[model samples]
Target: KEPKEQGDAKEQGNDDNSTEEPVTAISEDNVKDQSIPSPTPPTPPPQ
Candidate 1:
């Protein structure tokens, strides 16, 4: 039952993920542009 519930939740999350992706894309583009010279994406993920 627990496993089934988690599976359903993950499946449902995929539907909502599209809406969330644009926000992330905007942020990623902004960060990529600002830190083009530096590797902030990798650096921030670690910290």
Candidate 2:
């Protein structure tokens, strides 16, 4: 019974670790996309 419990815990840990990397990669990509320069604002019309 102890061995079975240990195996289940290890499997859950592995699943959690596998999901973390992709989340980190997507977050990094979002940061990079946001860093790009945007178009300049148009000049205000004369008053």
Candidate 3:
């Protein structure tokens, strides 16, 4: 499988989350996928 830089890893991460119960990691990845540097907080995990 491709190394899925970060964005893709996030998708899989979210999917894996529901199965693994790591919502925090999913939220963190969502933030990282947005604006790269603007991965602040309170604005991610809307998907």
List the candidates' TM-scores in order. 0.36, 0.50, 0.30
In order of lDDT, best first, we have 1, 2, 3
lDDT of each: 0.86, 0.79, 0.72
Q: Name the lDDT value of residue 2 in candidate 3.
A: 62
- Which is the better candidate, 1 or 3, if ranked by TM-score? 1
Segments of candidate 3 deviating more than 4 angstroms? 1-21, 37-47
Residue 45 lDDT, candidate 2, scale 0-100: 38
Candidate 1 similarity to native, TM-score: 0.36
Residues 1-47, model 1: lDDT tens digits? 99999999998899789869988999999988888757756778787
Output the number of the TM-score-best candidate: 2
Return the lDDT, model 2, position 21: 89
TM-score of model 2 (CA atoms): 0.50
User: Which 10-residue window in model 2 sums to the lowest lDDT?
Assistant: 38-47
| Positional deviation of residue 8's Cα in model 1 after best superposition, in angstroms | 20
CA shift at 17, candidate 3, in angstroms?
12
Q: For residues 1-47, what per-residue lDDT tens digits would candidate 3 score against the true structure? A: 56657778798878876876667778888877876756545457664
Q: Quote the positional error of residue 35 for candidate 3 in Å.
A: 2.5
